[model samples]
Target: MEVTIIEDQFILKTKVFFNNQSLQYLKKITGSRALIVSDSIMETLGYLQEVIDYLQESGITSTVFTGVRPDPDVSIIADGLKLYRESGADVLVAIGGGSAIDTAKGILYFERKFESTEGKEMPKPLFIAIPSTSGTGSEVTDFSVITSEGEKVVIIDEFIAPDIAILDSTCIQHVPQRVVADTGIDVLVHAIEAYVSTKATDFTDALCEKSIKLIFENLETFFKDSKNTQARDRVLNASCIAGMAFTNTGLGINHSLAHAFGGTFHISHGRSNALLLDAVIEFNANLGGSADGYAADRYAKLAEVLKLPARTRREGTVNFMLALKRLKKSLKVEDNIRSLGINQSEFEDALEQLAETALLDRCTPTNPRQPSKQDLIRIYQKCY
Candidate 1:
């Protein structure tokens, strides 16, 4: 006899605080000692001191580790873990962009893994994440993209998700407009990819739909006027909503190729995702001819939801890509990788290796379209 088991679950364990309530929440957080993880950027912006001051207000003694960098790797995580042990803090706080949050998660993830492997038991510290950027959604997602050697390794585990996510849009008000454009595009990619992901359930679809709509409504406004509180709040909320969707549904090859492209070229993660979004969507939709597949249908649904002209699935998909391109232009992003000023020869030289690395990326398995290495290379070529 043959037996089959079916399973489905939606998890939202992280408590989220919106508006400017993050500082208020900090005052009430339980813990006598805290370890704050951030980066030099946050420090220079005076945000690091702000967090320390709030923690002090709550009578929580703390230690700071401001060594996190963009695209944190194993060595960086190792250094953070060493600090975490030395500091002996009962609470762990990550108060910067995705890099700081990912670094914090990486530190905790390795510690937890080692404990399980070595047959040791230890109580997990209270983990809190305050995102300075609306991108990555690392605060609520269990996925961590860490660069190891030369490849970006995505570590996904239930244990890595943060216990609390504080969304204070004011944190991003001082950020550069270019960063606003990059992170906002990343949000769109997250929602679109999640909506079309093979693992997407009804719950995830609802979140993605809301997120995509909000992004359309608010991203450009926020990018143009960083001080628009209304736009900032909406876009920041949209980013978290998209994160929730993709965290459940998982993303597609857009993220995989972006991981490879960013790791190889030392490009920003959000920009890498932005450059690959159009090509990946086209590849998955199988644009011109066949629009009968799940991917095309979902893409069409997105276009319809966004109120783009869509008489058919193929039309809807194309229209959707066009809308994304329009958005990119408005945000002052380049049309392709070539326009981003990467040398053609250098990009060409890395295509094969990029394709190979992308093929093995953790995000690839759930991609609606299973791509060959050549298929991936073709995507890179298209983006170029």
Candidate 2:
């Protein structure tokens, strides 16, 4: 199956490889020279070398850039661009977690942006994303989050989406329990947010529902036993499914809040999203509000998909929220931002700024409920 999105004169399409050794096919599609974008950890895990060996066997010369950091900023992009230019590679391969993929996207995005300004025509490199972690799903999404001036900036364009996504579970077999939990919850949040997004269509809804079910059924097993190949594959596929869903439908305020809070506090993106999920869900439902009940009805439909008991829409929404809380607890994720160990005074000082920044986040537009700054503040406080 394939999905296509047409927005503002751009067409976005991604090809996914599931449970297959995608590297075997790399030779068939790649250019003669490849620029590998990753972090040091990928090197330590030997995954980087494995990729290099595959490329070499395919007669594709490759150079390495391992400077990507968590919540990468513009500086990382600058560094990567320098490496990309020096390598003179015609293919760009991102291997590692979301950070690496996002860094590669940043490099490509800024390069294109610069070329446009200079009125110089530069062909985009063949971009392939190999996710070593089952989170973020950056491999299939047209969105990249780059932190600049203490804000997580969202860059969206069809050009940022990778030409191919390699979803081999072998790459994630060594993921730590903490990351498994964090990224797993990220998949769930991505699914829920996309399912409730204002832009959701029947296609996105189906993908989101399937992704949510996969996470619920597989995350725990994968967390408990990282070597469980079946569980790992399921979760990895779920992450990609969620990624494809959100890329088309867009995410909601849960991601908006996460981007703001994470950029401000240096929290992991998935952890930030996990902490804020329940609060955002409740806010979006607006059970007692006089506004349109569409979001609430959607929430109930999701509950039905999950087989959660509900006598009414409100009851289903509440039950779904409870289920999420329970899942977080089982995964050992923190229930609230306060529990993540930010200083109370620091949090208080940053509350208003965070709320305001969240309101400006790109993900906010498709949120089922429009939120005032005060509303965001209250939600942050409630989570805190």
Candidate 3:
């Protein structure tokens, strides 16, 4: 039988909406038991209780696992999974940033692994993700980044994609300006990498184009004024739109290198991506200071979309990189990892392993330029 390629995600399966407390869908949940995965910040912010109260009102008993940390490792997943298996829950709710959502996903992932290992298939729980931060876009994406032995592992699995995504502006209201900067820049990297990915298609490009425009228009205002509700909504939309794009088209080396670098140096994922953005862009587009291939043209197209200077491929690419640098400066995020207090000797010592791990990251193969281990080392060295 002749068959066509079936893209893992053609239409987003997750039901998405915006609200004040992310409580609009609580009444619609069909399950009686829920495993709520979250973190201390959500507990401190009272968002955790809000979700719990909502679930209680829906007549759903819940198991709360609030031990999720930034860049969740295997141990968190194992612990959460143990709770999940023991709770006998039919619903999984992740109510925090990417870390918390990923913890829930990781639990589900290993749950599936357990089924496979034991030659049994358990009915998957209904998964819902409510992102407190406008970065990672973990609410809608079918990918999860987990830290294992000081290296970030990107787990790509369609089964773990949330059944629903809730964007609650209230949760983001008190986000630190520095976090806003980092998260907002992460949205840009997602859009850019998806746009230039070798696997990109017209459908993905359209989402990426809109996402990029939204970030350029609204991110600065959102960062500067947390009270700007309009900007907040737009940034949130941009994040989800970019997620839709990259989850379909996959991402590139910016993510790959960021994953490795962030894990090793204990940098925030978004900040790591921001530090690597400029060099990754230039590397993908050029070799020896001249624009190289289709990736350069793709970048030039993005420049055109942003209405930057795109008269020629090189000019457009340079202007685009310059624009990103300007945005980073405005946000006070410098491009140097060392300035983040990573020891020079430790960094130099880690370069080889970083490059090796980054080369194996799921995002690397989609990079417009196929990087060698030496190439990654050079990129790391240049950024340092």
- Sorted on lDDT, best first, the list reads 3, 1, 2
List the pairs of residues colliding in candidate 1: none
Off by over 4 Å in 1: 1-4
TM-score-superior candidate, 1 or 2: 1
Give the 10-residue window scoring lowest on summed lDDT in candidate 3.
19-28
Judge candidate 2 at residue 73 and give its lDDT. Answer: 91
Residue 45 accuracy (lDDT) in model 2: 86
lDDT digits (tens) for residues 1-384 of candidate 3: 999998645658788888565556676678899999999998998988888888888899999999899999999899999999899999999999899999999999989988999999879899999998998888998999888877788999999999999997888888999999999999999999999988888889999999999999999999899999989988988998999888888899999999888887788889999999888887898845669588899989989998998998988898888888888998899769878888899999999999998899899999988999999999998898
Task: Sort the candidates on TM-score, descending order.
Answer: 1, 3, 2
Tens digit of per-residue lDDT, candidate 1, span 103-138: 998988899888889999767898999999877788
lDDT of 2 by residue, 205-323 (tens): 88899999999899999999988889999999999989988898889889999899988888888999998887787788885563237788888888898899877888889888888
For the record, the alpha-carbon RMSD of candidate 3 to the native fold, in angstroms, is 1.6
